[model samples]
Target: MLPLQIGSFTPKAPVVLAPMAGVTNRAFRAMCRSYGDELVYVNEMVMSHAVVYRNDKTLTMMQFGDDESPRSLQIYGSDPDMLGRAVHQVCDEGRVDHVDLNFGCPAAKVTRKGGGAAVPAKPKLLQQIVRRAVQAAEPYGVPVTAKFRMGLWDDLRTDITTGRICADEGIGWIALHARTVEQHYSGEARWEAIGALKEAVTDIPVLGNGDIWEASDAVAMMAQTDCDGVVIGRGCLGRPWLFGDLITVLNGGEAPAPRRLGEVAEAMRRHARLLTDHYAGFGGEEHAMRDFRKHCAWYLSGYPVGPDVRRTLAQVSSLAQLDDVLGAFDPDAEIVEGGERIKRGHTNGPIKVALPEGYLDDPDELAIPDDADVMALSGG
Candidate 1:
């Protein structure tokens, strides 16, 4: 198979982990990275404002383990200057080899402030942000990419126009989530849109995101859209091994056997262990495991989880506690039939996008709205 090149850097595989907040931390990224040398694991979303302000939590979130070969960090912000500075700092500090800007987030909090998916609604503002970031990263030889949605809504889709802009601005590549901010993760992704994005831009590679729950789905997406690669988010929530499966399938090899409960259990344990290690500074293993509670549902999804067992696992405060719980459960059971493709992240959208007032009055508004400044912190 061929390598997926981003500027001078190359990923072992064309698979990339979408930068989901809270979930794609060092522990999680390390696990996903272990799946393959080529699979690109992007860090959780980092706010450019926070990075500019040197916010401790946001800085901590930017930490990457030594194992993340071809490290990529996704940064979100509305201010062109702030984003450019953030990208420059990351490059100057040698924090990562690649930087992906987030223009696809559809959360109300993000759009309310004129950030995230909202920036793409204003082509001029989007152009400036992308342009400044590219200029900043170019000096360091760090490839910069942008991931965006179809548009604010179907009536005002910007996927094609945004694709053209990124191509002209020297962006390394473009990723289209194939849904509008209003669509969230609810409706089926429009693969045809990915094809349209690919067709519209001839200079840079185009990647497809959304609805790739299984390795087969990635294969199907590539075949259907002819995209350069796939960006996976909620698909790997409790299934980091999906990266391995993708590698196997994309490389002309059969995917590994179905993960039994025991296999999943082992993965969960490793994840917990990594969490403990990652948080050793702020708090030790006990405190770190507290955060692991949220992952219980995803890890045990479709398992025969009893309420009592679920409660215990959710509240597990230490690695030993997790082990004891695993000890009592049978590990050979497989994930429930057809559970592999469970809808995990990004809800469907019919919600109105909270753009700044008059955002839609003119699509040609060239000035960056004051409301569109970078969020102090970033998330979905």
Candidate 2:
């Protein structure tokens, strides 16, 4: 029982799928959940502003497979009223089992507007956002959780403080991505910060994120920090089956054996099918085929393939092309041991944090500009 409980919801495996910007859609989540019976899959973070207005694209992005029980969605916004309205809107639609606030995002488009990780820098503003969201979801029994990074920058980290604040605001659970905006996804994650947060906050579950590239790493993190649960972000990319392995480990078994190329290739095909089926009207196979090109690098990573195969897969624009790409591989080949250690996703960081003037000078400033909401078509 790691991050085992949250109110009445007790995830059997307690392995959470962290929400990515453009990833983790309905199609992707269903595939991941299908791999593990108890996996908790979070939809990609959606800007509350978009949800409040009932943006078709945002609403579509929030879709979950019928079987995706305990469906989780991450909401990003800075306004209390708008955020509250957004929370209720999602719950009223009866589509969400959980709502996780996005205070951890370090994207420049988000931070520059005093949202995301920048919101935590202003405790009062963060409190407003969380309080309103929790209140809005209370009537619907939608458990509200929160996921965030360490802080805006290294010199100004605020993980422990934010943990206390979120716990105080009644967030059912909290996840900390043990790195700061400055570090982004570049430097090695500092698990020590996760331990510090676990020590500082005792009222609610403290789930640790970042640096968990393998199942054994999750075990080591739990042993090292005593955190309640492990929230996986990049580790599951192109390998939704990672959740299956996580389930085995949480159940006192070992992670699964190295995957055969055939198994991986088949999963890729299934993922493409799921995407096409779910996005039926949104370009159908044509859209799915193009969208899935991005996942090719992740799915077939480290496998032996020539430039021609790679190039062909790089711009896969149709199902026939996708089939050809998969056909070029030796499906029976095995993943070299520990190949998962290779890093992927948002690796650039330690860069200057974009922020409003004096955003860090006052923690009491609760007035986020009407413009601070992520309000983007993609990602926070």
Candidate 3:
């Protein structure tokens, strides 16, 4: 396997944790890293304006654990100047070693404003944002990277051009999600596009994203696409240990055996405890446990646990409640048939991309959509 090099930093493993909005916070990153700390685990995506304006919550979200190394952060926005300021602030302050620009978000709330996945449609504007971001980080010697979808939709493809622009702008590396904005998270990701992008962007490493649901999927993606590395997204939702599995398989070993229900429960407890500690300064354990309610479903997705237990766990607001609910389950039970392949997040798609009127009129013209700002939305 080829090692991944982002600037002067080379990860012990050629894997990266894709920055998911509400999912990839400090606790989750640490949880994933506990399984394997050598890979790049990016903090959740923050709006560039939030960083520039010093939004308290956003700034706090950027915090890293003491042991976190090669700290990576992802930011998104439409205005080059604002992104530049945000990148400059983080880089100058030594807050992050790697800064990733987000251009692949497909949410209607993002694209309607000509941000996220919509930004790639306007080649000139995309270039400006990437260029300014790279320029902002260059002086600090912090690497700048970008991730984007294949295009707005099937009819309008911009990944090749986007890759070229990012490479020319001095981006340290680029990741292709391999799904169009319209496709959202539905359907199969086009791995062939990753192969194409890797061929087109020879100067920098190209990482592949989308549909990496298991450790074997990661190995298969690298073998098929010849990408420099694999970015794990929805695959690691309930399975942080997937990182460990990836390390094993990528290093020429077989994946570990399936875990029992008790083991999964143990992981859940650890995750909950980590979240509680992360939010200790803000809302303490109660708030943290409440925030963890969503993860209950992800963790129990493939388990044969009864509906009553699932419902109870989903609403658990304290560590005591979590333990009580999990304790009722049989520890020896294993995952249901085909449970590992079950998708966890943003599974619906193929909807019309919400773009500003005439947003696609001129790909060469540099422009910003009306009513778009960094604070309007968060994450990709």
For candidate 1, lDDT tens digit of each residue in 122-214? 888899999999999998888888899999888889899888888899888888998887877767999999999888887788999988988
Query: What is the RMSD, in Å, between candidate 2 and the native fold over all Cα?
Result: 1.7
For TM-score, candidate 1 versus 2, the one ahead is 2
Write down the TM-score of every candidate.
0.95, 0.96, 0.96
Candidate 2 lDDT tens digits, 126-228? 8888999999999998889888888877778788778888889888888888888878788888889889998889878888898788888898898899888
The C-alpha stretches of model 1 lying farther than 4 A from their native spots are 1-3, 367-380
**TM-score-sorted candidate list, best first:** 3, 2, 1
Clashing pairs in 2: 2-228, 3-228, 3-229, 104-148, 104-149, 182-350, 262-331
Evaluate residue 45 in candidate 3 and report its C-alpha lDDT on the 0 to 100 scale. Answer: 89
2 or 3: which has the higher lDDT? 3
RMSD of each: 2.0, 1.7, 1.6
Compare the candidates by lDDT and give the number of the best one.
3
* Ranking of all candidate structures by their lDDT, best first: 3, 1, 2
lDDT of 2 at 378: 41
Q: What is the Å distance of residue 257 in model 3 from its true position?
A: 0.7
Q: What lDDT score is found at residue 114 in candidate 2?
A: 80
